[model samples]
Target: MSQQPAPRQGPIRRIAGDWHVIPGWLPVPDLGVLPVNAFLLAGPEPMLVDTGLAALSDAFVAALAARIDPADLRYIWLSHTDADHIGNLDRILDLAPNARVVTNFLGAGKMQLLGKGDPARLHLLQPGEVFEVGGHRLHQVRPPYYDAPETMGFFDPVDRAYFAADAFGALLPAEAASVDEIAAETLRDGLVGWSSVDAPWLAHMDQPTLGRMLSGLERLAPEHLLSGHLPDARGLAPLTSVIRHAYARGTTDAVPPETIRQIETLLTRS
Candidate 1:
């Protein structure tokens, strides 16, 4: 089956000083809208958090261009090798010939295996190492939950902004510009639901162990929690709170047998 087109346009919203977001809403079957987002670190380094959805390539490029000229982009941070995050990667590389793709070992290998990027333009990152771009130092931190092993998040000490690759994603009943727009219960349910689907291992995690993970983020107290699937969030409490509450007794819910079968069939066809 052909892929569905994502929403064409998403307004660029500023989350904090020099930190801006471009959010795209994509629809999922049986699930509501999922926010597919990319962030911009607008400063001396001028790095892009990730490329937006491929279905909205034109809009994504345009949104990114509006923030800063494609040629001016110095770094393209690949949070992971996931299609949603790396969708417009090549296109952006074409536009920003000077920008290097910053990613870890597995991410670079996946890009080569998938033929999605040029290795010559790749900057391989080491575990626990931080890179200094322009004047800002970006620390590599793994998110608590992710679907891909190559997944990595970035922490900006200057702005206290955390770019959580695929973690904290939630499927919402409707498109929201920010987490504050979502109701308390809806946000909780959506957060747990998406977590269950994206990282089923959560169901097997011990409560205290999970709490420690969630508590770690709480300790950071990021000014903005940037998620690939969630709208702009100002605080980590709202998100971490939901995960803690839902997973306290155990995981949220198990993936349905039918959904697994459907996925297996689709993979076979592909």
Candidate 2:
């Protein structure tokens, strides 16, 4: 049914040979894993996707050191500007002096406001622009209703991984280390638990925009979707079906109010 291929690298598991989630030793009390699933792009020129946070930097650095030369990090391909996504950005840039910063225009501006991502090293990505890196071609795409205008995600042709920013991301945030467990919790309370807490923006989403977003998502048919906050794949099947239904109903606000009322009732039962 859903792809649960052998844990790619034993208990730890590597989604792609080049990308693996390194577990951290010191997790921030209720903040889940210290470093939220950092992506290690290993090759002649390696890079770190998103650094954890200040609280987790020490352990994160040690983890990075385990499999990398630190200096070998050529660029930090940040997916978004959230703290967990860029917590250790300044420290990492200083550590990996050779590495430049790669993110969309808005993200770069945010980093600059914080006195990070110096202009010379700042790389801005436009939609449809593709670049070559470590034998992989990265194509950028902008998701609708983003927190920032320049919020964009990357699609890698080599590993066929689509870094879909916040789009298709499962959890509201990586507040817990156990992605699988959280995935279960969301279901236990019914599908509404997640949408109620995380998808609040859905109420304001426009029908046309929803159509466009789904259109962009269908293009990737991503095997691996790493979002800004959510990363659990357990909801792959149900979420797909639910999102499809929502899009269809969005066509003209045709989804009757009665249907929504029923959904609210279901939420209460959960």
- What are the lDDT scores of the predictions, listed in order? 0.82, 0.56
Q: How badly does each model clash, as a count of residue pairs? A: 0, 1
For model 2, how does the per-residue alpha-carbon lDDT over 222-249 read when each residue is reduced to its tens digit? 6665554444343234444555455444
Off by over 4 Å in 1: 1-6, 252-270
- Model 2: per-residue Cα lDDT at residue 266: 29
Which residue pairs show collisions in model 1? none
- In terms of TM-score, the best-performing candidate is 1
TM-score of 1: 0.92
Top-scoring candidate (lDDT): 1
Residue 262 of model 1, lDDT score: 44
Q: Write the per-residue lDDT of candidate 1 for residues 3-25, one digit (tens) a residue.
A: 75345458787898788998888
lDDT against true structure, model 1? 0.82
In model 2, which regions exceed 4 Å deviation?
1-13, 22-35, 171-199, 206-208, 232-237, 244-270
Clashes of 1: 0
